[model samples]
Target chain A: MAAIRPGALDPARPLAAVPPGDPGDPGLAESVARCLNDFFTARRGAADPTDPRFDGEVVARLERFTLLGGKRIRPTFAWWGWRAGGGPGSGPGAAAALRAVSALELIQSCALIQDDVMDGSPTRRGQPALHREYAEAHRSGSLRGSPRRYGESVAVLAGDLALAWADDMLDDALDGTDRRARVRAPWRAMRTEMIAGQFLDLHAQAQADVSEPTALRVARLKTAAYSVERPLEFGAALAGAGSGAVAALRSYGSDVGTAYQLRDDLLGVYGDPAATGKPIGDDIREGKPTLLLAIGLRRARERGDPAAADTLRGAVGDPGLTDADVRAVGALLDDLAARSAVEAHMRALLDSGLAHLAGAPFAATARDALTALAGHAVARLR
Target chain B: MAAIRPGALDPARPLAAVPPGDPGDPGLAESVARCLNDFFTARRGAADPTDPRFDGEVVARLERFTLLGGKRIRPTFAWWGWRAGGGPGSGPGAAAALRAVSALELIQSCALIQDDVMDGSPTRRGQPALHREYAEAHRSGSLRGSPRRYGESVAVLAGDLALAWADDMLDDALDGTDRRARVRAPWRAMRTEMIAGQFLDLHAQAQADVSEPTALRVARLKTAAYSVERPLEFGAALAGAGSGAVAALRSYGSDVGTAYQLRDDLLGVYGDPAATGKPIGDDIREGKPTLLLAIGLRRARERGDPAAADTLRGAVGDPGLTDADVRAVGALLDDLAARSAVEAHMRALLDSGLAHLAGAPFAATARDALTALAGHAVARLR
Candidate 1:
């Protein structure tokens, strides 16, 4: 498949082109780009011609999605974690370690593809999401079958394939150790936690009685583990970082991960649709049982407004809901202070995560990178 | 879900449990059992509580199928390949390597699950196949969707999950190696080849001009790469086997894999329904573009008996095909010498595989295992 060069909207610019401090300094951004390129090239080579294995549409979506310009926070986290744990910035081993970080980005892509399908999302990074793209392809007679189901099935298979590729990439990343069991622990944990968390998220959506605490718990397990703890700890573990360092990184990761999801909850409601690349009031339309939603429900129940309860319940997932209805629901959410509560939660989590990072044995550069990641993960209303 | 134990099938007498080096080698049997238990126990633990994962069905089937038995050729091949490449049998690494071999069983299960779904097969191992079982479940309940589609979807998901897990297991196996790139090469190649082969098979079936040679090529690429060459080479690679050893093993694996599929083709036509756990003439009913089918078509064309061709085409995949139609098709297949030709192919492959194994560095005991596997793969008539 031909590569989809990132358009002007690509996230790679901010993340992939960070300026080096000096000629003598290692260009981390360049390293990340090279690592990503190599990983993707390997993946393409892995495509067997005998299999009607490659769907051009799916491939285009993945290339576009993966190449989207965001700060390579996860990969940077992995790199920094390794560096902090006494791994050097050069040599074959270090290069492999960095490639391992690149693998995390691919895994992230897999997650987003499946998550978009499950959420019935329409847009990603200012473009129609994978399923939407495939659906359009079907509409245009570019492919045949039940478009919606085809989109879902293809996305599912693509995600599965990507997930497998990530492991293969990681297998190419670890070097110079007999610590196979120890190194495998975090990868295994990451996969297990992510899947478990996804199930919890699904279950929470299905059940009507989800509480704030329950929702938060799901977020921590599902989002936090993969987004922060596992990636950091996996890199750290691979570098033979001691248990103490791993424990500290875990604490830091968990806090940042929780805050990350809380910020996402806030964005799901009030963030600008243009910037977020999703429809305004999408979460409400989808009836996502987020922290904000739980908060709104609790407040409405306390006020004993049965009418408010009916309105909220009826409006959730009602795609035909009027803009006025959307505004009204947004007003109710704000009035209930749900948005403020989420902001406060985010602040607490950021503070806790940063505090945990204090006194860790990581290099100053890595510490800075982690702080930058936390800041970006919860960046304000934009 | 509660553990679904295998029904009364004695593990010791399983179809594939040909004990080597004295049937009285209780120690070896104990070691094998211990290895199997530890392998599965760890696999079960690998499931995360958060993911609504595949309900341990892969592991469950692995346990049931491996325990119910056929000749344990693949695992033995893997173990011997490792040992022949200079890996010692006493260390923790050895155990890990053995566990890796056991994972091939899961991969095989995955292949079988997907193949059965593709074939629209109703039974496996004297019971309703997974898809059929799920379909039956939906029928017996007040399910709210298309039961067949749901069954297919679930089975597809299950197979996908198993495939993902297989890579995960292999990744775990290759951890802490400096030869990460080398170790991962075969895995990456295997995945690509298998998926490509599947596509080729599908494409061949859909086309009217598929030939015997083309169909055979598809089988070899799709089934052979993973089943024989990849598994053996993956183990050998991990044990630091030289390129020569890897090449030799590949040659051996290719021949054996081709023979294995040839035997499968024969069984699909002529095997007893009770023994095969499928309805008689399943391949005929499915219109599988097998080598046998292609040959039969050619023979019928030469004889100018368009009636046989018409009957064969009409009956293939026709759910309403009668016993008489099945008999006619079977007779036609035999008249074309399809059965005998396939049997000859199997014999040639076995001979070639064993010949390739000759003068290799494998242990005498391991060589015996390989020979046994070759025999067992083609032992149906016996």
Candidate 2:
């Protein structure tokens, strides 16, 4: 295993960039942000203004959700990966790479909209979720009938539009001869894994007979693929990295992706509402069938607590569960060692991922950026 | 305009390669059908076996509703366009083209699934629409919970999955060096236009002030871009067509696509329920402000019939409107010469589209195929 050391800075800081907010980094981030804004603007321009289907509200919602705030981790990964693979950061190729990276943001938007709908979450990025907003808009007497249905329909459409736009942006970015084929494989894989992962996730939740092993498999497929490995591989592929480099990045990515998901599971149950932008214990209310839940179930059974099992089943989908109940459940999870098991898994994953990256043929600066990214991926818990 | 001639076969048939119920055409048709089936199967394989999210009923519903029973015009356009652009029909390139064409079918599926949700249509392809099926499944006590919501959610996820798969399938098919760039442009255009057009359609419906001219523009952008012109251009692009050829195909495609959409509008309002697999007067019930509606509104206003205008608006969204009332509205539409105007526009479009094709440097066979396609584009009305 790689001997990884914690960075000097607190890993829990949300943004990847430091507090001084590197003047140089922001410029690149701004460029990417500008590219994203321009891309959406041009997209809206392509629509017929007279069509009632082209809801400005829909576009506005997407823009606000997508453009507002998130760590531009994927784009940064792409940039760092390019530099690592001996590609320069300032040329026509670089611009194309950045444009391709912009696609990550669009993909993220697509995922979030669908995720919001799937999770039935009421808010996103400190605002009402798209579906909730639409539903509320219906209540305001602007639209006629079935706000819930309208919200869902519009959200679905917006998501579909974003997904299509992502492809278009990627195609436009890779229009050049040099990077076209090289970018295709990773681009395709990133999309496939996302969809496959989502399928696994939805499947795991819906199945009554889900086991602990099955839940872990679901997490690996759903969260791991798009979250880390694919993003890293996508960046590496853009740099024309060979199979060996790509494979190493994949290993690193998979480990980090798994760790990231495991941490997300932890946060889902125990994280503060203010930090997570979700209600405390929302996952438990939704019966998320998460890794923590699986572990807790196992532990509860091992302790011969039939009442605990019943309590869990009742609490899983109970929207009325209170903060006190949430705390109690959190304590039970901790007592059951579910939290520690996940943390241990995350640690092992981090070690394996960093170890793979240590021997990768990356420049020192690139290596540091990646290592920083890995630290950031797991920094929330620490 | 190109010369019009009478022949043993109806010129109105969209493609001359195969007639309705001909066995020889079934080979290619069957290949397409099988390809589509296999595509869905391969995709479904990725789903978890135990998850009710992959419920047999939903899969069966999707297979029954989305997978089967399309004219496969887009794929045919794609395949024929490639052949016309100098790609052989039997080589690896041709096979790849076929796969790409199959991807179009999947895209169409994505579009239709969402379109049903948008329009709230209760049936598709002679069966209960996906959402309706889910609703029914819930009502029948087979699946518990909000079936309507379940249907919509599943459909949205299915559409998302299908859209992602379309990209995957396209990538798999276009795994070649020579035609990658050539194929990418039109492929990207098709995707962008469809989404943009959908937005325009939605936007147009919300604003009561949408004019006839603007409605036509929306039709051109949304329908024409995806249906005829873009599909042909996509296929031609893969075969390395020059600018002139591409431009000619675009012009032809634009006209044909518009005419096709116009015909569909007519069918939506007046076609037999059995034939269209839509309830009679669906367009009226949904208040779809289609081109036909625009023409009818214009004519109604021109005739100084304020009462007719009021009646039109009042009757549009009335789900409980009687069959007689629907027929009466249909008659009023015809009395205002809306149908005639649409037919005139269709004829003009067909003429203009064929004229554009006439000047292109296409093989005689391909040109003939296009001519047949144009004839078919307007055939149903007569």
lDDT per model, in order?
Answer: 0.65, 0.71
Residue ranges of candidate 2 with Cα displaced over 4 Å = A1-12, A18-31, A38-61, A77-96, A132-141, A208-211, A358-363, A380-382, B1-31, B34-67, B79-96, B132-145, B208-211, B302-307, B322-324, B355-363
What CAPRI class is candidate 1?
Answer: acceptable
True contacts kept of each: 0.23, 0.23
Candidate 1: deviation at residue A322, Å? 7.5
Q: Write the per-residue lDDT of candidate 2 for residues B162-263, one digit (tens) a residue.
A: 787688778767775566667776776777667667655654554443467766777787778887778888988888878888888888888988998888
Q: Which candidate comes out best when scored by lDDT?
A: 2
DockQ for all models, in order? 0.23, 0.31
CAPRI class assigned to model 2: acceptable
Number of clashing pairs, model 1?
Answer: 17
**lDDT tens digits, residue span B238-293, model 1:** 78988777788888888988887777777767766666665667666655567777
Error of 2 at A317 (Å): 1.6
lDDT (Cα, tens digit) per residue for candidate 1, span A1-382: 1122233123223532332232223666567667767766656544524332353444445655676635565676667677667677777678677777787777777677777776677777777877777667555754422467555555655666667677766766654444445667777777656555654554454444347887788778877887778888888887899888888888988988888787777766666666666566776675556788788888889989778777787876566876677778878888877777778888888888888778788776666656666665556432
Interface RMSD values, listed in order for every candidate = 4.9, 4.0
Q: TM-score of each candidate?
A: 0.79, 0.86
Model 1 vs. true fold: TM: 0.79
The numbered model that scores best in TM-score is 2
